[model samples]
Target: MKTLSEDLMLLIEREISGQASPEELVTLNNWLSADKKNIKEYQVLQQLYRGHQTLLRNNIVNTDEAWQKVSNKIEILQNSNKKTIIYRWYYVLSAAAAIFIIVFFAWVFRINNQVVTIEAVAGNEQFLLPDSSSVSLKKGSAITYNRSFKKGRSVIVKGIAYFDVKHIVSNSFTVITNNTLIQDIGTSFLVNNTITKDEITVFSGEIKCINLSTKAVINNIIAGKKIINYSKGFVVTDFTDTNILSWKSGVLDFPDVSLTRVLEDISLHYGITVKCLPIDLSNNIYVKLHFENQPIQEVLNEIKLVTKLQLRKGNNEFIFFQSVKNESSQIKKQK
Candidate 1:
């Protein structure tokens, strides 16, 4: 379907907000079971809906009751032969609804029409937020905030973004993701939510990074700190990887980082493949380098020179193994 009918959208919203009738619940459930995309669409709507108790209470203007009122107004208008009367009634009702939208839910979200979406479709896109804070969104990342930016200064981030929040007295800033909620107390930070891991790096402020599932403090990161959760165990590193946000400045800085980590970052940054052979080249071996708008080939050559490893190329994949004179059987291609 090109679009869901207005009644269906209202039913979905009612269902999400615990106001759907039993019949409407069954109808929605049946619709949802018909297609997996239906569930995703509902989730998108739910994510876009803000969760303030006052807003929720205000928006609970009953769908059935409001529709009945509109219907009654139409019936009264129909008694008059003038078509202009009907048009005027519709205009008045629409204006009232528009006022409600502006007061309760206004703009980007289609729930009575009010939600704002900020995305970095290309490279790093910088946004000057409504609260005078600043955000630099990395490619393929997005954030959704209220169109009016009322209630509080908050945003839900998708991929990676750097935030320089302008702290308002008594109002804190929050950056939310699927797994964590980072509350910033007047500071600068970087949040990276990649496919494999979720990380929060604080550069010039303190933040409370919490696990959404457990409500546990993952880390209370201070200035010059980082908290990374990947592959199960988490790492709370202090005063480490201060240059983590270097990618925002078009500089890939890795000072004394493991070959494994270096390659991982290279793969993510340049969109290339770098596989470390399983051979015990001693995991302690590290690389210290910085690349500024350099080609992947030059970066690869730098790795080859520093590690003395042979790079075997195969169809968009690069495998680094021990020198040819060393064990050749330990070569492994990274997926």
Candidate 2:
């Protein structure tokens, strides 16, 4: 299901602010013109926004309540029409309202609560913090904090981040993720984020994992071990199963992951777009791919060579589809 379109975010600002720059206006016009369905889609979203506007203007809907209602509506829709049209429109409406509420409350809390805004797009990004610590961000990953970290202590994260945390004092720093909060004596780690979320290996040092939203957490895990959620709670894992920070070694580590997600990661790393046409793969396509020390095109060629996937250019870079050929290994099989 297509959850909200990215273009809607920009349009919300233009419409609400009523000060669209000449350039923005031109861009909007062009985008709407480029797609015959754009106007119809835009109108639908506008109608959705009006629902929120009515609640806001009438002061009948508490901001939080409105969002909660939206979330509740979302949960209901997800269960009933998971892969259907209702799921798509609900998400679009939900996210658009969220943006509006965030900006509105931001003004109200501007003086008291300084929210640190961070976004991770579909591309790999490098981060160097104030204390000389570093983080390598994966595509479609992100982390944000309400304020900056002080004394190399705990930091909150919303998306995947490989931390080369700066050395702190006798106390271990902490990292708060979606379902759990990790307390570290000193360590490097990886956190996988999604709408549902997951976590993995702590490369070095020890960590005390605790549930942030509930009463659950691992007692601790020393260096070279990993932790993954079993839904009930977190469990320890071994690096032998999968090496963490393999990306640092110039490879992506995917064990029975979705093929579309795999293509998405490749696109992010190569700064290109890749797709699988009419794509439906076993979703459990477990494969470890290494693209170390190679040019992006070479990487693409390698993937093509192995999967017999075809490369298509020009809606974006690296955008490719699996070729229609009966290859020996069109899709890698599990052992």
Candidate 3:
């Protein structure tokens, strides 16, 4: 009897689960064709996997009932005194136990390798990781980790998120985004990943940022520092955006900021599009405002009052224009 190696067992399990890659399938085929015993081993494992699936679907919760059923089948097989029949049954029963062990460990391996994804679809979302670290994702942001997250503290992030990482000296927290890896050195940080660039800001403690593509160490960003990584290179600078976490905080602060910049922030926070018709109005006007958890309509109304710009709403979009009265007055002045 040829014994199956752990690698061969895994390959058979992947084939049984229909998860084997093309190369893996070719390898399994070659092994199966090599010998008759290998084919028998594969058959036994396939039967085990199918039996497990059936047990799951049937909700076989009582272990004693299952064992009794197996014992009854064994007694029936024992009654067959023919030498060949008895030998085949004995081989099957013995292989069944070994196959069950392989299946059990394979199931555990799948569970440990499972991927967990968290997304903020309609609104901002907050979640606590396995290690009790907290993450706040902006609208349209998402993060993914493995089921064994505590053992290996790594997450892939998309869009923007704020992470208040729980520090473990032995295992460092790592955030991967847009071909860049940001490893926490006991830090609370914000990462903004866009199509064009990635922005990382360390709020407390420090972080080591690296470019995954080039395998280059970007910088060790300390608290109150930021790294903006572009396609060409990266720049480390002083962090200045206080409202960077406004989506998570539910506060939008614009202190003497241009109307254009404020509208851009508003669009991002509300997950909408804002357009100024003339475009000049956005550039010329400056806003000094603070809002906390206000409705989009209320915020736009307030902006209309201050900037005196006409507002129009469309599907997932808002347009601002100079009021007809203001346009007429300006025309008269020009004439």
Candidate 4:
């Protein structure tokens, strides 16, 4: 059997429901004449529609109410028919049944597939899933799962998130980002999805990563390991940074790291831009610091004391620059 496009399916539905325009009717008629297969497909859909109505009428306890709703719609269609051309009453009844059954099943499908989206308006938005798995979304990050998530544990992540999945026997938890799939083997993991690449850091247990486009298994990322997936390929590496979860943990630790790298982490943690004037100044400086649940200003003050760089704040941004006094002192020394 040939697969039908949604447009063709909708067209068939409109025709069956007696809602097709004259132009649409002509197009549908042409399609039907084009192939015997089209006729068979249409017949199959009609049978399914009628079969569902029969099953509902026979099996449902509220049969009267259900029948009444369909009858009312049939009456409305009949009354609204102003054309003088008389048709068989059975044909009109069939049309009404087709409309109700098609619409009813469509509504049921939509309800079953309804998506629930959770977004982190602020950083460190933590919540539990229906399966009792915990999720921590970074600010501006969002995750979507079907309403029936417990039946199938899967979510699509946008931006960055941390997952502590609750394992259930005979069931699997999976995270999807970009075109990659990360199937958790009872694990806690962090996923960072950017435009050009996706980074997965497994904290505990293991996860099987796959490239959805190529259907190739990338690697089984074990605990304390990470994987960077680019469009062309992927690379698996050890976790070099211990403070990767700083955003969720509310701890920013820079252990003897260069000033430039520290500023990058600070910017990401605070969701702001950090710039250093005379960029080379930041490159030459290094600092060791630890902050837990401290305000950005306090962190900046500590950095200012350690590196002795002037700090300035603007809208959603921070600047570290060489102080004018220090610049003048340097000029005098050079002279």
Candidate that would win on TM-score: 4
* Candidate 1 per-residue C-alpha lDDT over 248-269 given as tens digits, one digit per residue, 9 for 90 to 100: 7768887677778888778877
lDDT (tens digit, per residue) of candidate 3 on 173-225: 87866556777888999999986789998999998876644446755689999
Clashes of each: 6, 3, 0, 0
Looking at model 2, the pairs that clash are 256-286, 273-319, 310-323
Tell me which of candidates 2 and 4 scores higher on lDDT: 4
Candidate 3, which ten residues in sequence have the lowest lDDT sum? 326-335
lDDT of each: 0.69, 0.58, 0.75, 0.73
Residue pairs with colliding backbones in model 4 are none
Model 2, 87-162: lDDT tens digits are 5666769686786777455434332332344566755678776556687876666665423344224355666778
TM-score of candidate 3 against the unseen true structure:
0.65
lDDT for position 317 in model 3: 83
Ranked by TM-score from best down, the candidates are 4, 3, 1, 2
lDDT of 4 at 139: 85
> Model 2 TM-score?
0.47
**With candidate 4 superimposed using the best TM-score fit, by how many Å does residue 277's alpha carbon deviate from the native?**
2.5
lDDT by residue for model 4 (210-285), tens: 6644445765689988998876677899998867888889998877777888888888788779878787777777
Instruction: Specify the poorest-scoring 10-residue window by lDDT in model 1.
Output: 105-114
